[model samples]
Target: MADIVGSMRVFVRVVETGSFTAVAKENDVTAAQISRAVTALEEQLHAALLHRTTRHLSLTEAGSRFYERAKAILADLDAATDEARNASVSPAGKLRLHCAPGLAQSTVAAALVGYQRDYPDVTVELKIEQSMPNLVEDGYDVSLISATQLPDSIYVAQALGSAWSVMVASPDYVKRNGMPLTYDDLATHTLLKLETPVSPPDEWHLQSTDDAHVLPLTHAPLQVNAPDVMRAMLLNGAGIGTLATYSAVEDLAAGTLVRVLPQYRVRPFTVFAVYPSRRYLEAKVRTLLDHLRATLTPALEAVGERVEAMTNTIGEAAGQAAKSA
Candidate 1:
């Protein structure tokens, strides 16, 4: 039993640090001791775990699967230890999270500030990325993302909120070039294009309280790939661009930019908080999810309110302009 526990710990450490020598140094043990312990573990289980070479050690396919399960078990073991030490205490451990770039910057980042403040014992790490990572394989505790498709696998997901992709232009562009009063008017202005694999090509679908329309913005003179950079260009008065509502919250509130049709906005994109299922939940992951759910609710509300308000203001101004003309 002691050998099993010791080998498991060494295996987990090696996976995390990617080096047997590092694990040995940290535990004050010899590399041979580590190897023998792992071999004993494999022999007991009757399964080969590692494919080792002269210079490197990598997990076999079975070993890769085992490592995930083993890490979760070790975490639960630690939690059990803590509970035994202090029965009344709440969870405390390290949590790793994955998120998209826009959501990470505008929403998750803010929530984490309060989460850290509320739970000093819980350590949180964020992996901000554009690519959707394999949560179980990568060992992420939770992932906050916006996507329509999800893997129908052994994972559970919770819907957090929704976001919309909308058209926005700088105030300077509106003044110098001209505001687009209708769908047809958009053709006359420079449509600063955002190129992303997720969105439909040269097509934007927007809806108002009463009507819906599709505009093909393929006639754009300029196109950029990065959402952040495109938003930056729009804010700096370079041209009109479209992006998710969360990314443009601060600028919209300050009136540096404006929405085109006050009555119309795009259909909302869905957001989710996803994680792997475990028999026993760890304290760090539970606390982190709780904080995320609590803190991000207000952020979604604030961004939605701003969009609605901007829509109204633009509608009113357009109406008055027609009357004066």
Candidate 2:
């Protein structure tokens, strides 16, 4: 009967967890109820299922075989049911994602519309902030980030791509404080300092083609810790700003921001999606990561090409200056 099958599942859990009490708590039934179910199952099969002692529970040879087969049957049934529902509807579950504010707004947020359209049943909850959260403690299913590389303790991540920093200033700012034609001109202008969001905020690790240097500028004309705010200032001509190429895509496209010191590309930073583990990725989380990779890759690639093109222009200018001098 259907009831018998339901009882069998309870029995399977008892055996797998090795705790009748634990199974009872999860099933919202009494421990005695679990014992009774196993007893009835043993009677129906005409075999003893467990070797029990005062402090320990062990499976007999027959019980071990039964548990293995029963677990397989349950898994198969669950998978089949999921497939049937998938045919009728999209994935339905709450997926929580944490991301850098800039990345989330510019590209990740835009991609979610398409993901939602594809998986209408799934609800996405996003936490976009400058700081990383404890994914396990905060109950986030996934996180997306842009940085040098992730430390080992955090997550299992897939490297979506690498992006480099680009110097961008608003058209108004450049018009007022003539654009720096080369890295040497940086010293001549009022340098807008960006507070790196990394743990140690004081160090600005910037690299140019000629040499890599650390500018220990303890102060800035304006210091905004958040990338989103920095982008806003750069776009509004409040000050010049440095940000990952991915973060400046829209402004560059709309001609609000222009790349400066085009010959020198900033150090490359990696973009990654950190999930608990790639193997056990949940349906909703997996779907969203896949959607982001598919949707954002092209946009990021376009930004990279634009950076390279600007670099070429700076190189041409440098060559002309050398010839004239």
Candidate 3:
């Protein structure tokens, strides 16, 4: 009966959606799995539930009658479970998340630790990979991706926020080498590359409100593949490198790393929370997405605010120095 109950839900969705693929996407399973579920339901009841063809699916007479009953039964089961589960209706299960190497190291890792504290029922498995995987194929409940733009897909996405890339160097390095006040100053300094999924390794594109510049520094052949690695190298005074604000926020606040050119932003990338489907989204996945929006949005916004403040402070100081001179 328990087995029958699960398949019945799939059968109902297939009937309602009129396509196995649609139900498959909603359940984050393959269309074949949806077809098997309906087929299993038919075998259990000894009656055909749906007529299938290459173009579409149509409910058989028995299926029409069964779908109505099954929908009602599932509703009642949900109510009963909710009542038994108490007021919170906490979702209890394993939640899997896919993340790129950079974001997993920076913001998502901290957010997951906090989420675990808030929702003890969900156990998260974070898979750190450099490339994006198919959410359905990989069986990840959610994926947090960082890139300049999201690749076109059928999955639903909620954009958490954006983070900017900035040139940074250790405080000691700045004191010894002198700060690069203008773009031309960068050519003489030791330059390094920080490679992420979105950023190109060969050059840097810097933009200010009034000016746009490109610095193709072909020296100091050090390149790191991850943001954390880039931050570590910069903290040790390796060379001036690009670090995403999401990765640099803590160090910036601690004054461990200072923004080199406060007036110009190197580039910006977006972080997106993507999942298989919006409908019937699992409680754990939905809650985690909400938590991330609350967590990541403020951090992203802070980067912008901090950069703006730095620009103002630098401009004011330059004005003072010019007047004094």
Q: Write the per-residue lDDT of candidate 2 for residues 1-325, one digit (tens) a residue.
A: 3366776798788877998899999988898888888888888888998987777888889888988988888899999888756633455777788888777877678788788889888888989877678888889887888878677774788877667777788889989999887666766665465554442345446677677766554555777767788888787787666777777766776778887765455667777788776654566776777787898776677778876765576568879999999
Candidate 1 on 1-325: residue-level lDDT in tens?
5568778888878877777788889989898887788888888878999888888889988889989999999899999897755422465566789988788888888898888888787788889877668888998989887765566878878777777877788998888988777777877777777755346648777777788887788687677767888888887788777878898767777878777655567556777888887546666666777776777866787788877777777678878999999
TM-score of 3: 0.69
What tens-digit string does per-residue lDDT give for candidate 3 at 167-243? 88999899889999888999888898876777678889888889998778687668877777778889998879987
Model 3 spans with C-alpha error above 4 angstroms: 1-90
Using all chains and alpha carbons, the TM-scores for the candidates as numbered come to 0.68, 0.67, 0.69
Judged by whole-model lDDT over C-alpha atoms, candidate 1 comes out at: 0.78
Q: Return the clash pairs for model 1, or none.
A: 262-311
| Per-candidate local distance difference test | 0.78, 0.75, 0.82
Evaluation by TM-score, superior candidate among 1 and 2 = 1
lDDT of 2 at 15: 77
Model 1 CA lDDT for position 205: 75
Tell me how far candidate 2 lies from the true structure as C-alpha RMSD in angstroms.
Answer: 11.0
Candidate with maximal TM-score:
3
Worst ten-residue run, lDDT, model 1? 84-93
Q: Could you tally the backbone clashes for each prediction?
A: 1, 1, 0
Q: Rank the candidates by TM-score, best first.
A: 3, 1, 2
